[model samples]
Target: MTTQSLDESGNDDTIDWLDNGPVKGKSAPTRMCLATREHMPVSRLIRFVRSPDGDVVPDLAAKLPGRGVWVRADRDALAGLLTSKSGFARGFKQSVQVSEDLVEQVDLQLLQRCQASLGLAKRSGAIILGFDQVRNELQKRRPGWLLEASDGAQDGRRRIVGLAVALYERVRVATALAGEELGMAFGRDHVVHGLLKTGQFTDVWTKDYRRLYEFRRLTDDVWVSGTVGKNV
Candidate 1:
């Protein structure tokens, strides 16, 4: 994407963009959300492109060729565009086909990124596994974040949160992924509790998870079992 301009004149041009996240060694760029028609930091938006077949496809990396459209990470915005099926048509200035499953694709893609980052953090010895191990770690220091299974027993979650309260350790817990889903990163059949030490991988995983959170809720694919606690 060198340096391009956006205006009501409908001039869409290529501009140098860093798709992985925020830019470095250069100024951060902004793109307009087709659904909201608002300008925002590109890092908070996802890019889409039209294939030769006139099919709308998500370009999360923003490296796809051709004129592309940007949308807010929010699933509602994406769904609105797809529901009416005009946002892309207006942006592309051509009749296009929005994939019915594009929203799911975006959700799964972001989840995969989170899973990959979690695996990397684990490989670097930054991950604490099991309820006992996580409890021990929490007693010593604060972690980047607390990870719990979305489909696990609430007892483990309540006890952990209670421990955090007692230690005065303010921590954020995430249960967006199921126990079995998280286990994939560790080659285990199931994992209920986990913690990540503050580091680069933690930041990466959190960012991806936030995007997924905005996009949509998990499906039966990643959420297999357990009662996801609300208060804990």
Candidate 2:
């Protein structure tokens, strides 16, 4: 079954089941950001705006009023934009107070977005947690994505990932979130591993997951290595 979901702009976007998995129809017109100057999908970029108070604010959902500034949804690119000589001022064509914690703010917002996506997937019955449950699901039917806690023990993670590799040759594994953060998604004290079934929500969650993953890579090395499957 398919459902309609609202994008950031409150426009109805069609979510349909494809042969491979669920996909979201494009909703917004893509724009090139002054920072990157590359035409790309809106989902792959972050938006910003100048506040009336002469401060720059992140319009992550792109709903904020006034002229919008676009930046690549990448940690390094954002950091570079913030640090570059007059990057924000030049982009907006006016001097504005850029928050020193802009990057951190973006990271926090992206983290929350990812966590919310996971929670929605769980509520929709599209996610399964625990080692045995995920293992069985993988063996029976390949999942759209695999998620491992960054702080999870290596042994359990390896076992599950190995099973995924043996079954599907390649599986996308997301280890961007820690166990506690993942626990929030499952309403538990902690979650070591999880699986997202192929569906509309999985597609939405994957976008947030990739942003969080990339943001973490730029700021910290807290992620556990080998947990992210390259094959997928």
Candidate 3:
């Protein structure tokens, strides 16, 4: 559902989507859908506030000395914090230091996590990189997902895309993926090609990717828009 607050001129504004489904009409900050604690399985939908040290810690983690502020997880949700300062401040019942880089921090965290998973996948041999090598892997495993580089050449990417389409549900470009980063996954320092296989590592990567991509799609739809919706 949509959550809203009035702007300086008193106009209603939309908050980012923090929960299930898009909020109708109004904007609301997005909240984490999973449990607050790492040990719990039950879903606790709580909005996290950025701590003074610029850390996004969960309030339930500890009873800190001072009051905490709430923010949605996406960029739009963070933007809501800037525009609807009065409303959010009212909700917190205290003053909060809202920095412009709050959402950037969150974005960085998500990207890092995704990259780490890619690294793990590489270590496990569930992922392969490089043009010819990855294509060969694709032919063998017929992977459930494909990862093309965001900065890869159009014709080169298309040739792989065509192979993926031939294999159906088993190919995608890694738009949020960095060529250099993917290369590091396999012990290299630079790369633009990669392949993903269905295995324990793939399962783990897919789950983490689900959460990361979901949040990314909500805010920065540009990176994940076309490639993520299908195949990968």
Candidate 4:
């Protein structure tokens, strides 16, 4: 199944695999960004659709029903979607209400999705919380990813990351979320450090984290999935 919308140039855009959007081990197909006019993997784009009340909304999971508009997952691309007066109206070929805070909303949505992925890890016994437990996992457990509170002191983070780097081929550390934010997934007041065991949830978390990092980072640096270029 597919859904249709328009790019900035008013070209008919179709997402061939939008029915479920790469769910259940299916490969993600590509969609054209309304802003960039470039076709990229659906995982690298954010889907938008008109709500019942004519409001433009982000369909982060890409499962929302209706014809969908797409933009690259980058913050700049999304912002450019609303630059001209016509903007979404021109793409949708109808009047639509876009919230002034739409960009902020997308950022929060991606962050929440990242946290929700951690919740899945916790439920599956795939997560280790606390500084000491995470450190122990770094030493013994074949961890897939490292989670650290953005607001936590750098001392603990440096030690844990150093150990993870020494032991693993690549240490995927995410410090974009704060202690209280990470804690919400584990039902704690504060969680500064965490480790995720190699499994399905880790992969999901990585994707969400990458999108969040791309949306929030100030620099033009892109987030690559290989060889720790920089901490996210």
TM-score of each: 0.77, 0.78, 0.62, 0.82
Candidate 1 positional error at 174, Å:
1.7
Q: Give the TM-score of candidate 3.
A: 0.62
Cα shift from native, residue 84, model 3 (Å):
3.0
Judge candidate 3 at residue 133 and give its lDDT. Answer: 87
lDDT of each: 0.72, 0.73, 0.52, 0.75
Angstrom error of the Cα, residue 112, model 3: value is 0.5
Model 4 residue runs over 4 Å out of place are: 1-25, 218-226, 229-232
Top candidate (TM-score): 4
Winner by lDDT: 4
Q: Which residue pairs come into collision in candidate 1?
A: 1-15, 1-16, 2-15, 2-16, 151-226
Worst 10 residues of 2 by lDDT: 15-24
Model 4 TM-score, 2 decimals = 0.82
| lDDT for each residue of candidate 2 in 88-186, tens digit (9 for 90 to 100) | 666665566777788999998998898889888888899999999999899799888888888999999989988888877767788888899999877
Candidate 3 backbone collisions, by pair: 14-27, 15-27, 15-28, 16-28, 17-30, 18-30, 18-31, 146-172, 148-173, 148-174
Ranking of all candidate structures by their lDDT, best first: 4, 2, 1, 3
The Cα error of candidate 2 at residue 105, in Å, is 0.7
* TM-score for predicted model 2 compared with the true structure: 0.78
Put down candidate 1 lDDT per residue, 1-232, tens digits, no spaces.
1111133455543333223432345464888788887888766788888789778788776667776778889888988877763557766766677777778898878778778888888889999999999999999987777788888888988798668656753566677878988898777899999988877776677667766655664453222221132333
